[model samples]
Target chain A: MGKYLPKAIVHSDEIDRLLAVEPGWTKKKSGVEKRHYAKSETASDMGAEAVKKALQNADTTLDEIDAIICTSGTMEQPIPCTASLIHKKLAPARPIPAFDINSTCLSFVTGFDLISHAVANGTYKKVVIVASEIASVGLNREQKESYVLFGDAAAACVVETADEETTGILAAKMETYSEGAHLTEIRGGGTKYHPNFHHNEQDFLFDMDGQKVFRMSSKVINPFVDELLQEADLSIKDLKAVVPHQASGMAMRLLQKKLGIPSSQFINVIENYGNTIAASIPLALCDAIESGKIQRGDHVMLLGTSAGLSLGGMIFVY
Target chain B: MGKYLPKAIVHSDEIDRLLAVEPGWTKKKSGVEKRHYAKSETASDMGAEAVKKALQNADTTLDEIDAIICTSGTMEQPIPCTASLIHKKLAPARPIPAFDINSTCLSFVTGFDLISHAVANGTYKKVVIVASEIASVGLNREQKESYVLFGDAAAACVVETADEETTGILAAKMETYSEGAHLTEIRGGGTKYHPNFHHNEQDFLFDMDGQKVFRMSSKVINPFVDELLQEADLSIKDLKAVVPHQASGMAMRLLQKKLGIPSSQFINVIENYGNTIAASIPLALCDAIESGKIQRGDHVMLLGTSAGLSLGGMIFVY
Candidate 1:
């Protein structure tokens, strides 16, 4: 992997409590500041903000973006997709392609992959990818095990042609494992238990088998990373930083050990951001880029694993 | 556009009505006598069922599938994607690559596009794309405009490479109109309007401006269809059927008038399905295949539009 597009970020502290949740009965872990939770944060608001910041960082404007692929909008509380919402919010003068990418926490990477392909294929010149999450609300807030494990955030990156170097997106792979879905799930909405206008209580809460999920993560995630590394033609020794999903301490530690990446090599933000799910990876990247953890021509890997039991990893050059 | 892959379908009619106020709505859909629905359906249940049907239709087990992409988990719900829910249901089997495809209702077309590309590119042979929607549960049963316009159902397609004469997918293009998002949306969910564990009535109900949506459909849908036809170098003269998003009679009729497509050439099932949204296209296709309304080697177009104010059209030669 080689060069990367520049990015920047801004966040709120209220959302961070959810990001810094300690595991059920365990001390907090990692470099994350605790996630940014919005008091009334919505995907569009966060996406707009992040896009503003990213464009500011790039010293560009919305008119310059060729396209924007956003991965946000949860069904838990149900609303119009963040992409559509953002599209509406966009200045009419800046009418570019924008749509929601719904691939779990891996959505950002998925957006990353799609934008890269679009750019690589020369279909679009400059693409914007945003990973925004407003997850703190759909939770069973009283459930200590899950409530604090999330925050609200939106992170964006602008990808464009560069003659200077070759450190952008190099290789990426996405997979889904339905067999372990029950390990973690928000049991209500959708076709099975379609929410009614009546809003039934007993049947509409998020449920999960924590142990089962931790086990599933242990079983498939990092192992998947190893496969991605092989595909990218790099190894743990080659990567400058590893930006993985922000789910929990249990899943994170197991992944770190399996990959043998040192604490520093791991771009950790979970301690402060708990699990922003789809928003975590890019949020971390935004923070890392700002903190000087990732620089031009550096090789990095972004991995994701979440609700669909989906796992994906990509090799990114800087 | 050249090769063929018949997307396998999984279907059932069990407990379809329990999800509806007019429990009989399931069987009343145009040309659709029965369909799959959860009694208290969750996205996972519908998605899982469709995956099972797809597995059975394709004569392949879970382990054999390379990927599964789907939609419809928004109850503002969180934890896992509807894709994960299906993956979890395919238990004790090896994990399959999976993710959700959501550009809103066009998810079917989007899912099809992804599967087709992977197969054509020789990266994967078996891919499952599912669109499960229990829209009925999200809107008020009393709102005849909303309730009478929705039916809870799911559709899955297991696609694979095939040399069989003319039985498969064709070319597709996806487009989004993020502008119309406000015309149709579930409105509450995510960090913005957290689902009150107490069953926020506002959170559960779907909000749509029927007249505006109709206006968009009337004004834009036909143009979208015409563009696809023109791209294919064909015309209304070339299509045996046009399966549109099952939204409403007014929209469909307006489309038929604008395109000058005879009522016969226009597929009708919205009255019964009540706009299954993403499920409408494939659901219509399933019935067409089984009922012989659309024969082998026939040309058909699948069109989708939903809350994202998103729009997409695909021309399939099946």
Candidate 2:
């Protein structure tokens, strides 16, 4: 696992000043103390850095990787999937398949779950899945609920056939309750509300009905986690670590409490990193692994609720 | 296989009139006689229609589908991936895993190839892959080269475990040469040139250097196809049908000639459909299957070069 954050780290104090709020208002409202914000770094640049770190951590080179899959919530450019741009930055010695799998904030979890099967089936010997987000770019400063809740970062993992029989995905599931699709969204920058045809700046910025998203997610998450754990024939107590998407401080707290997991078992990085969109889960997972909250041979669960109003979870032994 | 086109049908004559060009010039330059343009339809709307037709064709209902994957070059919205929106429109009886695999024009090819492995391995029993594009919305009408070269459409296919032993993918490969990534692109509609911060109208439009794309593709396609055939241990003569991305008339003619594939074996629908971005391959494939050009147990190859400057091919026994 690997991670990369841009050099510009903005503290909640900075956001408070920028938004002309009280000193602790930004942190209190968003539960973000400090987070990385990209000034000039591109998503692909951060992603490539993460990939390089991942390769180094795995003690492997790009030559050993069979495929590169980028799971990004927001793209750097609309054409040539973000993976290709990351590939361009990496400049691998040989050509390899590069593509993207997007599921909003749950992109990393979705990519990991799906690609793990491909790896186990011998379709690819080794693959690099990178989740990179420049969430700071699209924030609507007028909407404090979402504007200060996102950060810019990239995280990557090197996945391959498991060397140990027990160290593999035990169960993975994703369900989309599209009824909440409108709860969280960037309505512009696509065909439906294209920039060329529409000039509303607000549409291009990130917009979210935080209350609706919370309400929708609260209703679905419990049962979704139950289904995931049931599929693996395990209980929440069996997990050594639970890496959930750093969606927000309230969501994480509520989810952890609802799941009845101890604070030590639930990974939380939002206070420092904010919500990095698709990079949240993998970034938090990396932190867990690096901090020894999760270790080899330990059972872990990765879970998240994405903008699709989708619930995704994967149980596996690390 | 299934397909959907919007209510509006646009002929080259209309384009000529709009561009103040001589009659027949649009068709002569673009090799596109007429194409469908969306008036009020959305990508997800068309994608749901295609998914419905695909389900009917497969004699299955949404309840039987284990997953939904949307492969589109352009998205309906920037958040909550298009697959989720399609799922919303379909309103399946139950929640299913829905996401997106994007590789620009080769999105369907990539999704089909990758998801085939998942199906064969029993990760999913049945999956629907939909490729929908609203290329007309992003066209730069002032740039006639690409202005009349695109249309809006959607196509989908139902994939599941093959009952016949011979009906399956034999081999598949994709290689990205990102050096050509800049040759074709929609530079805006994403984080790098976001509409909120950047107001250049030209940046949001589809931009392409046809000559550069051709030069890049021509240099890599022959060897790429050779490698694909070698991997499958089959020669060009063995393929009963060749379904290539209806990128453009010139590209199709050049690739077919370079590949030494006979016209009878080549699938061409660009003249009638124009270049439907990611939907081109599946739309053409559906036409081929419906028109009896490709039959059961036939050895067929699906190939395309996408905006990533990526070459992809899959040889399978249909």
Candidate 3:
């Protein structure tokens, strides 16, 4: 696992000044002390950096990778999937399959779960799944709720056929309740509200009904996690770590309490990174791995709620 | 397989009038006699319609599907994958996994190939892969080359575990040569060229260097097809039908000639539908199946060169 955080660090104080709010208000409301912001870096650039780091960590080269999948919530461009651009930046010696698998903020979990099946079936020997998000680009400053809750970062993992029988995905599940799809969305930049149609600038920015998303997610997450754990015949106590999406500080606290997971076992990085969208889970995973909170042979559960109002979880042995 | 065309049927003469060209010039230039243009329909609306038709053809219901994957070059909105919206429209009784797999114009081929592995491995029993493209909404009127070369349409297929021993994907391959990524693209509507930056309307429109795309594609296609055939240990003569992307009339003709596929065995729909982006290949497959050119036991090859400068092919028993 690897990650790339943009160099420009914007502290909560800076956000408060930008939003014309009182000091400490940003952190009090959003729980984001500081977050990375991209000034000139593109999502692909950050993604490539993360990929390179992952390759180095694995002691492998691009030539050994069978596929590159970009699991991003937001794209760098509308055409030619972002994975292609990342591949272009690396300039791999051979042509490998590059594509995007998007399920909003849960994209990384979804990609990891799906690709594990392929890897287990011997369809691919090794693959790189990268999640890159440039949330700073679409923030609506006037909407403090979403504006202060986003950050720019990229995370990647090199997944290969497990050499050991125990080191693979045990169980994975995803369920979408589309009734909450409207709770979080960018209304323009697509055919339904294309820019050519003269939609206003506000239409292009990110908008989220945080309260509604929380209500919908709260109603379904407990049962969804139960189903996931039941599939693996495991309980919350068996997990070494729970790396949930850094959606929000309050949501994470509520989820941990609802699931009865010990605070020591739940990974939290929103204080420094905010919600980096799809990059949140993997980024937090990387932090947990580096901090020795998770190690090889540990049973880790990746869980998240995405913009689709989807609940995704994967229990795997690292 | 099933498809849905919008109610607005646009004839070449109408395009000629819009472009102030001589009568019949539109057909002479773009080889499209008539194409569908969406007036009030959304991509998900057309996609749900196609899904319904596919479900009816398969004699099944949404309740039987294990997953829904939207493979499109364009999106209906920028958040919550398009598959979620399609699922919302269907209003499935259960929460099945819904997501997107994108590789631009080759999205449907990528989705079909990837989902086949899941089905074969028993991860999913039945899956619906839908490609919906609204190209008309992004056409640049001043650039007659791409402006007249696109249409709006949706095509879908129901893929399930094959009951017969020989009915499965024989071989599939995808390779991306990002050197030609710039040959075709919509440079905006994403973080790199965000709407907040005040990029002009042209940035969000589709742009293609037809000559470059042709030249680059021609150099790699023959060998790519040979590799696909070699993997299956079969020659081109064994293929019952070659369903290629309806990229352009000229490009398709050249590809057929280069691959030495007979005219009768090649499925061509550009004359009626133009290029539907990601929907083109599946749309052509639907037409071929409807016309009885491809049958249940026949060997069919799906091949295309997409905006990623990617070559994708899958040989399977229909």
Candidate 4:
């Protein structure tokens, strides 16, 4: 493996929970039915699994990695980084480098940039990136609106250098938006609502202004796609499949419709996966790959948005 | 001022406390005593002051910067992003792109790569980067042992394509260690410890394995610096100064000794700045420049390390 190590995609939905909320709680609007919910475990486990898979998939060992780039929105622990915790699963003597990115959903894209540059610049020979989202853990089951829209899943991508043209990722573009940060934010524990006092509980809930997020989602969807198009020197006509972030089925459909494409032209995982948040983009893209929708030469457009109101886009050929 | 933006460096007394409990607390061998500390305020304010100085030193206006990259380890509010908060302080409208980097202390190096590549490959022309840290809010200030070693500080740099051979940044590198994420970290508040429970207030405090961190720190520092040194084709003898993360006076001195450089050859800011975390690297470099310790054609090595256990080193000549 070059910059990207071996990765394995794992999804969990085995946890049994009561689906009590909003309308159509049982109905999977975007094809998303049940998402993996961690009981006592954390997102790091999912990340760890992916890391393990990536290593096994690539026939490499954890000690071989120069560094591990962890991209996720669901931060599992505070002191020990989820990545570090995951790394702890291995030998402590093999203290490989690692860090986490909080660019919201843009994390993977940012992760790609970090890994790509590291490899490009020769700081690392092999690096691993794991994208895991435990959205189900943060959203209260009581909030059917948000609950039904999320799916918890993790995907691993192993990037390695090869003469194979299709193997190396071509180009990527990742950007962030702080003006719309509050559009989808978990307003707790951060400095904004932090408390030194012991009685101050209730700061860790995932709170969001859904309508605002929808509005922001609607606004950025096209311009970014256009920017990506211009940068890649490609067009809607050239893309074989567009993997927009799996947020709401309505959002994906709207973007697809606005782009004037058949529903088949878009990858729809929400119907079965709900919204995996950051994991949704990669999960859907990889799902498209697994389902044989993608070919070796087809250009794929991956766009995602996160709770930080962050937006990122990356294009690669499978 | 002609080719690069000017910045101010500030250090606090909170550094020793950090080094004291650093994973290898028994080592008690931090090379620097003071780091940097920020007063109770928004990261943007601290960053803004640095930005203002950079602007004044560069003799430019906010409108001149095509984009601003606000880098911070401690943000007042994680939502708006420290950069966006600074953007609100500037003219909100003029196409000035802003965002923050959480690569831990390697942030500036990461920012260096982003902008350098953006300007080199993308459409950005003039870009600025701000390194600001105010980690005190997360500490148990009651524990003077930890609080005294960290201080709040911010530094700014205007990066642009200039026709100068004397003072301009050259090659840069970035890498992360997910394993190192916990080297220095706060143990609570995200998905791991559902901060919604009021009794877990202590989880919000920074919990670090000092000995583990220092050991990891020394381990990663040399290799990282070597990467940059190789990339820049510079030997230790070719460099005029080494501006490292201001973890402590003892740490810096140790690094100097390890690097086989005289104490005078090292740029020391820990005594005044404390451990500004991500801000230390850039802040110290700026201080070296302001003090005239670094001059035209001098090769400077900027190294960063922190909580995510990430380490990055880049060599630049100015």
lDDT, model 3, position B310: 93
Model 1, residue B29: C-alpha shift (Å): 13
**What is candidate 1's CAPRI-style docking category based on DockQ?**
acceptable
Scored by CA lDDT, what does every candidate get? 0.64, 0.90, 0.91, 0.63
**What's the count of clashing pairs in each model shown?**
52, 0, 0, 77
Give chain B TM-scores in order.
Answer: 0.82, 0.98, 0.98, 0.84
| Angstrom error at residue A130, model 1 | 1.7
Model 2 spans > 4 angstroms off: none
In order, what DockQ does each candidate have? Answer: 0.39, 0.79, 0.79, 0.33
Candidate 3 residue-wise lDDT, B74-116, digit = tens: 9999997999989889864568889999999999999998888
lDDT of 1 by residue, A1-318 (tens): 111121322232332454454333323332334455555545676777787788888888877777667775353225555666766666433435455667667888876765565565455778777777666556664555565466667778888877765766667887666666666666555434444433554334555566776777677666687788887888888888998887777677777888788988998777756677677888888888888998988899988676666777889887
Candidate 2: tens digits of C-alpha lDDT, residues B1-318:
999999999999999999888999889888899999988899999999999998998899888899899999999999989999999999744688899999999999999988887898898999999999999888887899889889999999999987768688888999988887788888887878888778888888888999998898898899999988998899999999999999888889989999999999999999999999999999999999989999998999999999887889999998
Decide which is better by DockQ, 1 or 2: 2
* Candidate 4 per-residue lDDT over residues B1-318, each given as its tens digit: 211111333323233343454443422443334343344455666677788888887788877777667656555553445666666565444435455555666666666765565564434667778876666667774454455556667788877766654555655655455565655667666666666543555568776666677786677667777767887887888888888887766666667877786667688777655677667777878888888998867888777666666666777777
TM-score-wise, the better of 1 and 2 is 2
